[model samples]
Target: MNCLRSILAAGLASLVLFPAPVRAQKTGEAPGVQGSKNIRSMKEIRDEGVVKQRWDVSCGAAALSTLLTYDFKDDTPETSIVVWLLHRVDAKRVRSRGGFSLLDLKHFSEARGYHAEAFSGMSIEDLALEKTSVIVPIREKGFDHFVVVKGFVAGHVILGDPGFGNVTMRVDRFQTLWKDGIVFVVHPPDDRMIGEKRLPVAARLVPDESLISRKIGVTAPSNYLY
Candidate 1:
C-alpha cells in the first residue's frame, strides 16, 4: 500500500507538470534554420563539472545548486545547498513530494542574485540566458521532474535533467512536455563571478540583428572536462 501510494503521488505530479500535449508549431523552415546562432551549448558547460543532485527527491535543490554554482565555483556539498534551498522555500511537502511552490522559488531565487519568475510563455531571447539557467518542468518515468536548461543548440533546448545527466529535445516536443507552460527562469547577476569571461565570437542575434543594432557576443565555458 505504501508503494502504491508513492506511485499514485508521482502520477499526480506528472499530471500537474504536463497537463496535456500541445500541437507542434508549423514552421516551414528546417530544424537547422530554427537553431539559435552563437550560443554556448550545454554540452560545453556540463563537461565542466556541474553538480548533480545527490538525493532522489532533491531535484529542485540540485537544479538550483547548479545555477548557483554555474558562474561561481563553490566547494560546498550539494546536499548542504539542497537543505538551504528547502528552508528558503519554506514548504513541508517538498522533502517528501519533491517540488517547490512557484511563489517560494521566485522569492528565494530573486533574493540570491537572480531574477526568477513563473511564466507560461517566453520568447527565444528569454530562453537565451547567457549565465543563468531555466528550470523547466517535464513529465518522465510516470512522474514530474525538473531540468535546468543551460543552453540552446540546433533549435533544441539543452537540459541538465536532475534524473538524467544531460538531454536535448526539439523545441516543439519540449513545449508538449512543458504543459501549462509553467517555467521558473533564473537570470544571471549583473557582475559575473571571478574568471568568467565572454568569448570574442560574434553571434547573429535571434529575431534579427536589426533589433539590437549590434552583433551579440557569446561566451565559451571553461574546457575542464570532469
Candidate 2:
C-alpha cells in the first residue's frame, strides 16, 4: 500500500510540475503570443462591410465583396455580386453555392478594370512583405472554401476567413490546405477607377438566401463603371 501511495504522489507532483501545453483556439483573434504585435486588419470589413456567407456557399462572392468594399471603397451587396458573377460564368443561379470558380473571379475582376492575376507557384516566402491581399481557396472538410489572405504575422498567415473572421495559421499548414497553391491577387486599376462598369440586367436578381433570410434586398445591381 505504501509503494502504491508513493507512485500516485509522484505522478501528481509531475503533473503539477509539467502541465500539458494549452492549445490555441482555432478561430477569432489569434493568441497574442503566436502573432506579432504589429498587426494590420481591414477595418472597413470588420465594420459595415464584412460579407457573411450565410446559407449559400458564396464565399467567393463574400470575399470579393470584402475586397471591393474595403479596398475599392465600393459598398455593394454581396448577393448581388454573387448573381453578377454567376451570370459572368453562365452558372444561371446563385443556389449553385460557390459555383463561381477562381478563373471566373479573375475574369470578372478584369472585366471591371481590376488587375487580377493567378499564381500557382508561390511560396510563403514570396508573400513576405506583400502589401496587397490575396484570395486563396482552402480545402476544409472535403470542400474548398475561399478566404482572403491578409498578410503574414510572425510565422503564421493572417486570413480574412469569411466563415470565421480573422484567423492565423502556420504557413506550412496553410499551404497544405490551400488548393494547388492557387492565389488570385485583385489589384485596383492603376487609374484608381473602381468597378468601371454598370451591372448587367441579369446580375440584378437577389439571391434567394439574401432576400428571404437577411431581408436585405437590393433595388438594382451595383454599377461599377467598367
lDDT of 2: 0.52
Worst 10 residues of 1 by lDDT: 1-10
> Native-vs-model 1 lDDT?
0.48
| Candidate lDDT values, in order | 0.48, 0.52
> Considering only N, C-alpha and C atoms within 3 Å, which residue pairs clash in candidate 1?
35-155
Write one digit per residue (lDDT tens) for candidate 2, span 37-154: 4332223223233456653356677778777766577676678776677566555433333345666667777777788887776677766644566777666434566777766644
User: How would you encode candidate 1's per-residue C-alpha lDDT over 2-102 as one tens digit per residue?
Assistant: 00001122232222221223224454667667733444542343234345655555566666666666634534455765566666654455544445445
Candidate 2 residue spans exceeding 4 A from truth: 1-49, 90-98, 191-226
